[model samples]
Target: MSDLNKLGLAEARDALRAGDVTSVELTESCLKAIDEADALNAFVHKTPEIALERAKAADDRIKGGDAPSMCGLPIGVKDLFCTKGVPSQAASKILEGFKPEYESTVSQQLVDAGAVMLGKLNMDEFAMGSSNETSAYGNAVSPWRRGNDDAQLTPGGSSGGSASAVSADLCLAATGTDTGGSIRQPAAFVGITGIKPTYGRCSRWGIVAFASSLDQAGPMTKNVRDAAIMLETMCGHDPKDSTSAELAVPNFEAMLTGDIRGKKIGIPKEYRMDGMPSEIEKLWADGAAMLKDAGAEMVDISLPHTKYALPAYYVIAPAEASSNLARYDGVRYGRRAQLAQGDGITEMYEKTRAEGFGHEVQRRVMIGTYVLSAGFYDAYYNRARKVRNLIKKDFEDVFAKGIDAILTPATPSASFGLGEMTEADPVQMYLNDVFTVTVNLAGLPGISVPAGLDSQGLPLGLQLIGRPWDEGDLLNTAYALENAAGFVAKPGKWW
Candidate 1:
């Protein structure tokens, strides 16, 4: 049981069912770890009392012979989701004191499946940044490298804390939201596995919007199976989210065929960019080789619109974000700016928004406002939407041409110094999602699997993308890759 900190989801659950441990004990262990490693800032809200209480309920249910899928495990919930009493800040000061009257559909679904909520994890303010520096609560450190007095590294955002906490063993698995590369990138930065299910697979009912069309809630965990378990508990149809697919949730766990003996994997030719470091390129080449060794036939495919993905995402995401965030104009449940004005309510709105949002958020709001304005709407926003449709259509064409999944690099480079990227041009920072944004625009299921490490000892990852509603295949394929590559390693200095 002392080794429980490194145990995967299946192993941990078996430990509980075999009476080798109790839910309360696991929850207490997590609470202790979180307390001891407070410097990571991995969590924004710690509700140990609520967690223990829920663990007790889970134990009672299990003893009564009625345990559900997740049984008594502890899990971290990203702060973007609304909790009835918990302050859901989205890691931004604008929503600092806001609390919701109801729980998010995904959060409620997790609770229903018997998973204990350990706490609310930190994230980029409304899931914006790639390296997590934009978080209002400060950056979450990667659990991978934390000793010898070096500057702390980012735990990738906007799901940074979710990845950090899970890798550090503060929780069994954590919830994450991906808009652009939020889930997969952070998971890579922290040396873990995360999946962004096909858009509309997981409900977005209570999540703060980044780009409504792009934002998706998914799972981050230590291993592929844990991700599967968490996703099984997360996905379903929800009436509140109009974009949610009405189709029935498939049995994901049962669908993992492990044997990819005859599957065809597409290696998109556009992903092999000129700027990628030689080492990462080697990782990709070796990764494809491993898949070939596992009997998957690899072929080159083209997404000619790939270069347009980043610009398209920047336009579409901010445009939608601008409209959605307008609801937070002081009258609703967010920051209210104090302004002296002779004008009516409009002045209050002007002042409140001006002072509440951070620089990045402000920039996005202004851009969103400009793009959606009457004169520019057709030229910018409408054009971007049409391009987004083309990106999705490209994926549809490739998959229909008989490819089970597509492969690519998660980020152009492995985790660099936090300020190295963020301090540069913001467009340069947006380019980190160059390889990832297209999947989001296409509304596809994408994942990042820990492939190997760069010379700097930073972990590198390869992404696997699947057709809509085919997350099980992606996970299974990642599992096979994991088996072949055998590159699993936690943050060497985390302990």
Candidate 2:
């Protein structure tokens, strides 16, 4: 038999149902893989005891014929999700040793569906940076590398550990949260499938907040079908989160019939940025051609505000982040700093925050604070909100014109070295989110499907943005693209 850790979520589900394997066996396989792949830094926390306990219970439930699709599947939870008694640090020093008393709504729902928790995965500090370099624990390295270069690469940011774990086969599938391009970008970098549901599709109640308006929880998996299965388990209505959509969750896997005939896919002409690599342009064109052959009609469209998405997103996200991150003071949970002899409350606050936050988190908080400051609010924050509305309107106009989903390159390039952009201007790192932020800004569902490999043998992905509250349709289109693209490449195991 093949290694159990190599099984995808869907495959594991089918195997469990057929009595060919038990949840405990799968959980053990993943735990062993997690141990062997420690150098990858995918999992920052390991819950072997809890995982086995849950797996045993899952075996009972499956044998009793009361199993859900996710029953007996082992999954890695992103640190952003508050798992009860497990450290939910959001990859920041300020949140170090903080464990929530209550479970995150999304994670609890997955547990209720019989999914076993492998552990908490690493991520960018407070989900702030575009590359995984901002993580306080250290960067989660991508499994892929340039041909014989042996230099480590990044697995993308915020959800980097989630992407790394899934791509490295450290876990069957993992949870990821997207604010800006966290989920999709990392997934693209690691050659996997990841989807960000419509903004309110997944509840945000227990997940650590990073830009309250843009943060959303979704799954990072090895393939499109596994993404469908995991996403179905992660979404639902929660009264605790005012932003949670009140729609009924559908069987997303059932929607993946791979029939996109007569569906209209829009190609925004504005995405063809100057100096784009020929490989990316060729990959995008090839993806469109595949969809066309699969019977999806290609229509040229434009999102006029595309050029402004990155700037507007930077302003709006930081502004919201400043507001949401204010709760982390010395008085509350998590880490606190030792006071100097003459330090006052003001000094304590300054000292605690300075010591607790990573450099990137501090930068974002400063930028956020500046934008929302009294004199600059109108010039930066408010203006950015207006631009955000225009960006949303652009997408609305495209969808109104009968575009089922918009197709674009998931990232400008494939995975790069971990410290490649860290030395340059921060704006260079921010540009990594250009293709994905608009989806978050517009509160639309978007997915990244691995389409092909770049010249260096690194993976490249294509993105599909769908109408609000229309993830089912978006997923179906991604399924068709996945089938037509037929990208099954995996990184050679060097970790």
Candidate 3:
């Protein structure tokens, strides 16, 4: 029990039930790890008191033989999810002091399942950046680094905090919300397992909205089994969120037979972009080979609209974000800008926003507003919507051809140093989501599994996009690929 913080969710659950470890011991171990790893800035708000309280309750339930799969387990909650009385800022200054009066459906579900909350993990402001650099609380540094390099790297954002914490063993698992590549990319960078379930699989109620249609909450864990276990408790139908699917939640962990025999896995030909790094290409090829070796048939597939996905996603996501964020005027909760004498309401609105939002958030809001403007709505927003449907149709066509899952590299490259791309054109930063935006556009379940390391010794992951509502089959295939890859290398502790 010395390294109890290192235990995955499954391992911790088993240990708690076997009486080899108490929930208090496990929670305290994680708390100690969090205290020591403050340099990572993974958890912006540490709730050791609440965690201990929950741990004591979980221990009693386990002693009475009433433990659920996640009972007595300690995990991190993303700042995006509103835990009652806990600071849920979404890493934006606008909502700096705002605390939700109620818990998010997803986080509440985890609590109901007996999971202890360690704290709110850091993330990009309003969950809007590819790297965690946009966070008002400051960047969540990745624990991984190049050989002997001291330059801090990003734990890909906006779920970077969740990724960094889980990767560094600060927590067994953490919740992450993926708008484009937020969850998967960071999970890849940190060498953890993350899945963005098919849109509507998890409720969005009480979570800060970025792009209403694209945002989906998921789990980032140490391994596939831990992800599977955490995902089971995180997803379910909720009346509070009209977008939440009415389908029954399945026991995803129980479906990890890992027998993907005869499963047709597709390799999209269009993912091979120009100037693609040799390592990423080789990693994709290696992932396909692993799937093939797992008794699955591999076929070359065409997502002809793949190239258009990135552009369409940018247009559509920002447009929705503009609409969703319109409610944050000075009249509502959160910070209000100090006004000069005789300042009118309009000035208050403008000043409050100007002072509240960060650079990236302002840029996205402007872009979104422009796209939805009367003169350009049809040209940009409407066109993007049409293109989005076409992209979704592309996936449908591939899945219709008997493709059980589509395999590709999770990220274009490994984790880059902080401020590396941000100072350049923002498009360079946006390009990080090139390999991930399609899954959100199609509303499909996609997972990133740590497949291998780049030449710099940083983790790289392979993505598997599954048919909608078939996360069980998807997890099984990821399980198979994970087994084949055998990627067990962890970051050498420097923080």
**In order, what lDDT does every prediction score?**
0.86, 0.93, 0.94
User: Candidate 3's residue-wise lDDT over 1-495, tens digit each?
Assistant: 599999999989998999999999999999999999989999999999999999999999999999999999999999999999999888988897988899999999999999999999999999999889999899999999898999999999999999999999999999999999899999999999999999999999999999999999999999999989999999999999999999998999999998999999999999999999999999999999988898999999999999999899989999999899888887879989999999999999999899989999999999999999999999999999999999999999888889999999999999999988855599999999999999999999999999999888999999999999999999999999999999999999998
Q: lDDT of candidate 3 vs native?
A: 0.94
Q: What is the lDDT of residue 62 in candidate 3?
A: 100
Q: Best candidate, lDDT-wise?
A: 3
Of candidate 3, the 10-residue stretch with the lowest lDDT total is 418-427
lDDT score of residue 82 within candidate 2: 97
354-441 in candidate 1: lDDT tens per residue? 7777778888888999999999999999999999988888899999999999989888877756677655478887877888899999
Q: Which scores higher on lDDT, 2 or 3?
A: 3
Q: Say which prediction, candidate 1 or candidate 2, comes out ahead on lDDT.
A: 2
The TM-score between candidate 3 and the true structure equals: 0.99
Q: Candidate 2 — which residues are off by over 4 angstroms? A: none
Q: Return the TM-score for each candidate structure.
A: 0.97, 0.99, 0.99
The C-alpha stretches of model 1 lying farther than 4 A from their native spots are 146-149, 341-343
lDDT head-to-head 1 vs 3, winner: 3
lDDT of 2 by residue, 1-495 (tens): 459999999999999999999999999999999999988999999999999999999999999999999999999999999999999999999998898899999999999999999999999999998778888889999999899999999999889999999998989999999999899999999899999999899999999999998999999999988999999989999999999999999989999999999999999999999989999999999999999999999999989999999999999998888888888887889988999898999988898999999888888889999999999999999999999999999999999999999999999999899888964599899989989999999999999999999888999999999999888899999999999988999889987
